[model samples]
Target: MRPGQRGARGRRAAVTERNPGREVSAAKALQKVRGQIRLHLLSHRTSVTASGTLHLKEGDVPYTATSRHQGTASVAIKHIPQELVKRKLLMINGDVHDVPVEVVLILKATGGPESAGSSAAMYLLDWYDLDQELILVLERPVPCVDLRQYLKEKGGSLQEHEAKIMMQQLVEAAIELHSKQVFHRDIKLENIIVETGPDVPRARVADFSCGCFARKGHYHLFSGTPKCAPPEWYMHARYKARPTTVWQLGVVLYGMLDGHPSFDTLRFLRNKLPINSELSQNCQELLQMCLSKVPKQRPTLEQLQHHPWLQ
Candidate 1:
């Protein structure tokens, strides 16, 4: 069965069996709560910055400027939310310690609870609502660049071994996001930052503008990049979260190996786009499995973690 078809049918059956009025009321309540959350966040315009912990430094430069998004850097601070500090979410040189706060300011475009602690993902240290513009205070890893720029500086592609190291970390990050019920709808080179200070580059997933809370059921709306969307979305107009995530991982891997723009979904579906044959057998297999036209054929995040190429 196509993805979400079963769920759609089941929902239809339940609609016929349950009280329609109650369902409508429940949906309204959910929307009301979401609205309240937004209002609360917007009302706290200066609470974060006023706390004296986070300082917006002068002479801020564009940290990561892509056609899609941009971020600015600021000075380091000593204080952060106690919850984040307790969780030891921030890492400096691969160690969990009380370190100074280096922040990047990204214009917030999405609404959700703060991101959960994951070293593989950038930490949302603080946020401010300024005159209807929401700005996110994100952790800034010193001496790092976005993966897209990194790839460009490295001659457009990474070697298989180097790619493996980064890919493994990315896969683990995806798993952690899902486990925390956060669905990072867009996972691509531009949204990932590569920390060059480390011996082996560490990948930190960033930019959650297209993200939402992970939930069971089909997401009818598609907010991610069109070129990177899964085939299932084009064919059925609906997609499940996990399958879509796996497909994006494949897209990232393909770009890393091919040293080209991500394959157009339509071209790939038409079979005009092919995986590079020069890649090793294990790498090719992993790519093939991830880019499978059938969503069910793709390996789960856990399976990807244990894939031979990554191992």
Candidate 2:
């Protein structure tokens, strides 16, 4: 169930300061704040704010060093949002929650905000629009690493039991996302963050820049990783949300068990890479069902949640 939207009393004071005598609804006041907060914060930071630089107060600067730039996105740490703090939304791996932050800020800045709602699997804390670039503040799980690096540390492939635990969590996350009408097009190892500090490793799905709202029709334009795309995108040049998501889940599982990247669409179409036979029969069956060439043959997210392999 989605979190109940709580009215923010603080917004009234801010709204009344600007427009005296004019009463504004809490929703409208929140919308106004979302629109103005980014510009207000950016302008008050310094005399001159660099195009891509995130300047915090002295000794509070979060970024230490720089690295090679690949895509348009880059990572840097900074302060948390006071707005979010006011709502008491900050917590470490807490219960599932949602903040009533405007969707426009996230959607306009990141191109993907459909999945930004409450989910233990996602860590979208807050976001700001800096005109030239967008600033996204995500939750950092201490003593954690990406699933790809974690796999390498585990001798390149995870044991069936470990993989089963991780896959069960991921499938549950997928079901939650599906219930909220959020289709995360990219569900790969690199995008998944695993918290190793816990007794059992916990997985948190990250990177929703390729996400969109779940719909009934097929989507022609694919925004996720090319190699991990479903076969329908290659053969038919179109794919639906759930089927494609299942296909990507299959790719993630294949990567975890095989310790190698899954095949590209063309190679998968030709059946160049097969599921590892050494895996248990249930695991192999789930892989086969998910990696089916025909989208219709693949099990739904609900079925995956109840699959014998996961159980």
Model 2: per-residue lDDT, tens digit, 152-218?
8999999999999999988887876666556778788987889888899988777554565567788
What candidate 1 gets wrong by more than 4 Å, as runs, is: 1-118
- Deviation in Å, model 2, residue 172 alpha carbon: 0.4
CA lDDT, candidate 2, residue 127? 46
Give TM-scores for every candidate, taking all chains together and pairing residue i with residue i: 0.65, 0.66
lDDT (Cα, 0-100) at 119 in candidate 1: 58
* Worst-scoring 10-residue span by lDDT in model 2: 46-55
lDDT (10s digit) by residue, model 1, range 175-209: 87676556777788888888898788888888654
Q: What does the lDDT read for residue 48 in candidate 1? A: 23
Q: Backbone clashes per model, in order?
A: 0, 0
C-alpha lDDT (0 to 100) for residue 225 of candidate 2? 77
